[model samples]
Target: MKSSTMLKAATAVLALAAPAAAQDVTLRIQTHYNPEQTSGKLATEFVEDVEAMSGGAIDIEMFYASSVVATVETFDAAANGILDCDMTGGAYQTGKNPAFQFVGDIMGGYDTPYQQLSWLYYGGGKEQAQDLYNQFGMELIGWWVYGQESLTSTTPVAGPDDLKEWKFRSPPGMETEIFANLGASPIVMDFTEVFTAMETGIIEGTDYSGLANNQSIGLFDLAQHATYPGFHSMPSDHLACNKMVWDGLSDQHKRIIETAMEKLALRSALFFEKANAEAAAELAEKGVTLHNWSAEDRATFRKAAQAAWDDWATRSPEAAALVESHKSYLTQLGLISQSE
Candidate 1:
């Protein structure tokens, strides 16, 4: 009789735990980061957090390094249901609409990751940015701003005047124009060829990843002189899911994903902050000259970016609206004035 009662008790416990053990859905997500990168490692942590918070109802399979498709195709893949989510920068879709450039990276717009995140969270960017993602058939969960990118330059770019006639590798669009305004000759080239181009004297420097990432890739070794606490080009990577799938999720699961994404963004920004600091100290010991531009120099670069931003806005109506919204919000924060 006692044994029978114990069996019943055991069965009840098993019944209660069974639901938690059975995962309701498994999401296939893809990102452009490699597994070895700090961002990639943090992304894996986010996956673990979601599963834990969902009590095993959710499982995420991370495909890193653009293994499933090219980086630019990630958003479309999520929209078409080829993948459940796209974890990449929105700038890749600028080819589809210029509005994406605003959503991706507002080069020289915000000085720090925190300010950019503030614009997204408190300054009404969340809703406005969501509309752009909705048009592409994906839901923008949130963004992880990696902070400003440092440049690897063979010549010391200590001030704006130093940029005059300086040949360097540059990405297309706003970056090219902004530097061109400063009288720098920006050469458009594939990122893979930056090292070779610099080596062959085709370019003198490359505006590349954050200091830590650039160090990992050996850019500092070749360039010798570098820029730190970069004042230009901070891009935002997003976690966007298919709207249909997102809408289908229960409110509880949706909250779990949303909350986890918020945590992921903060953690990612913090990681790069610490990593870049460490990289600077270590590189300095190795005799690399890391330059930080003066306040006046940074402002000059931003002023140059103004015309580029306005020029890009003319590419599409959506782009024009986004640019207006940004200007309005910046004015509200006293970050900009209409006359400037």
Candidate 2:
């Protein structure tokens, strides 16, 4: 009887340990998009893919639309160990670290998002990128494009002159400088609050991702007019992991995450291009006027971008090198003139 009782007790103990004994890891991924947006969709896909690949050993709980942490403070949360990982735009953390603004600034003139990623991952930028984040106790996972940000306003803007004295809602960092250089007052506002700000007349205009984002955030409803020439953001969302959490991840898990992010990076860029094209067409059919930047206007924007780049570069030597390298690349490609 005693032997039988002991065997039963052991069986119960085994049963209790089964789930955890197999493997156990949980990572919290925080982002600023609602669960319905494109970035949210991609984030969901990434989480599921990682779980499936790990065979249930790893789990990532997504905190979307800043449910767990506010958008403005996500970088700080991830760095301070409040969150394990974050999918956020590099520029949003401008106040935390100015060097990060270089990521968004260098892309203003790049022809394709892929080229920017190439420079970041393989073109010697990663060292500086990691160093910038190292100061904040975070590790740079990689970069992902968020699509070109278009201007949306209640009032029409044909050129830089029209932007003067206009209150424009924008994300932080280079975007603020971008609009400021164009003579618009760049108001730093949470992306989620943009729609309300427009409706209440708190801000006159704003810029956000192509179509889905504009519609999802209800920007189109408040601001009927839309314009192209997303001069502010050659925008890309940077993925980051807390240094402590990253170090704790098994080498195998680290490799898996790295490989997955690389594929997702390409997938995300293509998705943005596709989504932007489709969304733009749908909005146009709905009677939204799509303003195209004229040759003269494009040149003016280029000049503004250059001035903004120079202003940021002067703040940090590393930033200056990044800006110079990107310009050199563009000059060699004949996309922009060296004389500029």
Candidate 3:
């Protein structure tokens, strides 16, 4: 071979090799959960799993405790590609898109964790939710439930009447409406603000996760009174990815992410259950009293909550259908009463 021709071939080979060697991509994973908390741990684990699964072809940089973005801002950040992933509540973004409220609006009807999980993954619930998200230019990658949330307050609450004269911290939409129906003054604020608000008495009480999560944040320390059976959030927590980023991944990468999420979901559900149980015991040790609602009192509260739901449903046909669908599902499974 001529020396010039040989030199040209070597140069071409190096050029191709250089491009391959320089291939690098990084994804930012954001969430409001504390980095040391279960949700944050799982998120970080998912990032690691993604890195491992992709063999370092894709690097995920995780930002927790809303460092990169606040919980309420996650949806917009992810949709706009400011962040590549987020574990957030679909309903918190209701101001951006009403359809996100569909999740929170009908969550009251899920009787069990298994039921909610089934409905979300295999029962076409996720697809419908994804359709809603896609409209906002994001995708619903995967979601997990962290069980129900109950009220933690400075004063013990056994009935709706007890809720009066209390300012309760609540999320937007249905939750606010529910609190209003119970006669509690609703305080709308982001989750991060709840701790400080409670500490400074900006709010008298807040509806947060089960015992363990609250304990981690010292929420139980601020409010010694805890109520059982959070009718509002029969289930809580969500995990999502940016739509464009999700679609841009290879099929194999998508499968890895989804599978990792499923495993993480199962782990998280169990973790939440165990944590709440343990936290209940710890609360007693720490002088926090747990109050379970009496049958009549619960019935009364439910009736009032139902009234609120009815009012909301009447205001939005889509919300009404979601509530009815979940109700029908529960009725068919004998988890709830078919009558009224």
Candidate 4:
């Protein structure tokens, strides 16, 4: 009888230990950041945190700098199961729908990273982004707005008027239109070509990335004129996964990823703000001219960008809806005039 009781106690102990002994899941995630960059470091930290939080049951296999797939292809790759998760920006998916532009860039809409982050979490941005991603068979896990992007130029660019007759590199969609409105000839090219194009005088400037990222890449060396505390673009980098994969995750695993991403978002934003500031000072020391637009100039650019926003909203019902959501949120936060 004592042997029977011992056997039952051992069985209960094994059942309790079963979950801990479960096989570990390693998700393959891809990013556009190289290992040395701020974003890359944060992504690594996020991976570590997830592993710790999941008690080693979850692991991340990270691929950097589009090694697995190009930035533009990450969304489709993740959706198709070639990649379990993609840490690229939503802007790359603009080719899929014009609505993505509203979700991705928003041109002159947001003044600070925190404002946009708030809209994504507290406002309707999260739901709208999820809806858009669902249409593409991907899941929107989370996003980070690191910092504003600066324009690097061989010549000075103070405001919209200064862009006239200038040649610059820009991304596709509404950004090209905005620069076109300023009378600059916008060249759409892959980001990798910016340095060579600038060196060969193929283009005079580029609105590529944040100050620190540009500095790290030596953009300031070729283009002496740079904009600081940039007012133009603040792209939100996303953490997305295949919808099926995301749905299949255990509740504990899903929460770990979501919580880790939220921590990363806030941490990256703060890190970039300080990093960009330091880069500005470093560039100034290196004899590079940095320009910060006046309030009047910013207002002028914002007004022009509003016209472009209105034009984009008319492109499709989805785009129109996204714009309206942004506008309403901006108004509630007093970032924009309600009548405007």
Candidate 5:
């Protein structure tokens, strides 16, 4: 009888262990940020939060700096099951669809990170973004609007007129067109090439990362003039997963993943805000002349950006719909006049 009792006890223990083992789900994620970058740290925090929240039911293995795939190919990689998730900017997909330009980088549409995040969560922007991702066979989990990007130049850029005849590196699509409108010669180059190009005088400046990130990379050592509270681009970084993989997740696991992403987004915005401010002070002490354009000057740049918006909207129905959604929201919020 004692022998029988031992067998039963062992069976019960094995049964409990079986369910625990079956609960594990591992997701492989790729990101565009290096492990030491601010966004990269946020990615690491997100993995820890999801693991803890799910009680060990979910695991995220991250590949940093586009290690798993090229930056622009992340969407296709996730869609094809090469990676389970992609933590990168959506604007990289502009070659696939012009609509991504509107989704990824709205150019001068938003003056701050919070405004863009507000629109994404509460102003119907999320649903519209999902529509775009759905067409590509991926699910839009969440996104982060890190901070405004600054222009680093050898010369002061106080107004749109200052851009005239200047040579600089600008990302593709809207930015390239917008700068051209202001009479600046825009060069399209990879982010990795910016430093060397600047060092050799191949380019006069670059509209690169946030103030803190630019400072971290020592851009100020070469370019004396830096723009603060940047007036132009605020690129939105996204977290997306394969549609089939996402659909297969249990409702509880899905919620945990989504919650983790939302938490990361807010944390990233707040972190960049503080980091950029502190970095600006440090740069000033280092002899960098920081320029914050006047409100009038900002309005002038915004007017020029409007043309890029109109041009993008005419690319396709999807592109047109995305532009309309942004205009409607901005108009309702009094950010842009209805006549605009």
Candidate 6:
């Protein structure tokens, strides 16, 4: 995320377009992304559309790069009225409830963003996620999932067994437990240090961003071997508003915000899909070997991941509910058998 901030302002012409009955709202919002990133650019467009749709009555003061607070605190900041919305994600709130882990990034859950989205929109995820957000005094608007993240490695990680051969950067929490059980050494490190760690051979791999994002950061130059069609970690970025603020908004205004957010999600998903595809072609020319693990390997990894999910469910009733919901939905999607 970039550390810069650029305020998007609504024009007076749009202000004149507000319906007389609609209440004018000025929302102060902060996101974990910056203008330089794709997600940030899409979000800026979303805010602009919302402002225009609401005839400028829904003016937003947007801050990028978690300028108002730390990235992880964005949800709580919104809930406490420090900000009007949390344009971050649920994963950072795992400290509050293990259920958040399910909402944020269901590591090794589904193969694609579409599947994860299906569970949310078509399946029961929408209602369940909303309920989870409501408990924290926040209202769930929608989620933007770009795609699964590729694991950058110095050496080839062709299958599950390869993980044990090297120490990689891992996020804190359940992920460490899952990877550790696979006989791999998982080190928790900040994302910024991943390059230097890998350069010095302190770490052999890193659980980084999507294929395109990693390529943009020149990770492929260092770690020529990568697991494409990433097998783990597709985190959902949320657009959540404080429940009180959301409830107080005009129905039309609420719909405007929701509709705009939907567009942002779809646009982001497609953008990343195209980017990764292009990046894949570029990596081929650059001699970077893209690895897509075999189905058997994916299953093995999923089974291990599911075990961690089950253990996490034991941490909270809400977590268990979300896990069961995911299992039922994954079954419906044919990604998991009914017996599983």
**Best TM-score goes to which candidate?**
6
List the candidate 1 regions with Cα displacement exceeding 4 Å.
1-23
Q: What TM-score does each of the candidates earn?
A: 0.91, 0.82, 0.82, 0.92, 0.92, 0.93
Candidate 2 lDDT by residue in tens digits, 1-340: 9999999999999989865433468988888777787778888888888888888788988899898777778888888888988788777766655556776445357657777787787667777677777777888888877556688988877677878988978766676776687778989987678778888889988866665667656677777677663544577687799998988888878877887788778888899787777878888888777777776776777778888888877887667877777677667667679897
- Alpha-carbon runs more than 4 Å astray in model 4: 1-23
Candidates 2 and 3 compared by TM-score, better number: 2
Q: How displaced is residue 69 in candidate 5, in Å? A: 1.4
Q: Show pairs that collide, candidate 5.
A: none
Please tell me which model should have the higher TM-score, number 2 or number 4.
4
lDDT (tens digit, per residue) of candidate 1 on 1-340: 9999999999999998865433388888999999898899989998999999999888899999999999989999999999999999888889988999998998888877888888889988888888888998899998998788998899988888889999999988778889998999999999999989988899999988899999998997788888888888899999999999888787878888889989998998898999999999999999999889988888788888878889998999888888888788777777677786
- The C-alpha RMSD in Å for every predicted model, in order, reads 4.5, 6.5, 5.4, 2.6, 4.0, 9.7
Per residue, candidate 4 scores C-alpha lDDT tens digits across 133-180 of 998888899988887999999999977778998999998888888878
Name the runs in model 5 displaced over 4 angstroms.
Answer: 1-22
Better of 4 and 6 by TM-score: 6
Model 4, position 300, has a per-residue lDDT of 79
lDDT of 6 by residue, 235-299 (tens): 99988899999999989998999899888888988999999999999998999889999999999
**How do the residues 1-340 of candidate 5 rate in per-residue lDDT, one tens digit apiece?**
9999999999999988874333679999999888898788889999999999999889899999999889889889999999999889789898888998887999989888888888888889989889999998999998888889999998888777789988999887889999999899999998789889989989999988899988888888889998898979999999989999999898889999999889998998999999999999999998898999998888888888887999988998888988998988888877788888
Clashing pairs in 1: none
TM-score of 2: 0.82
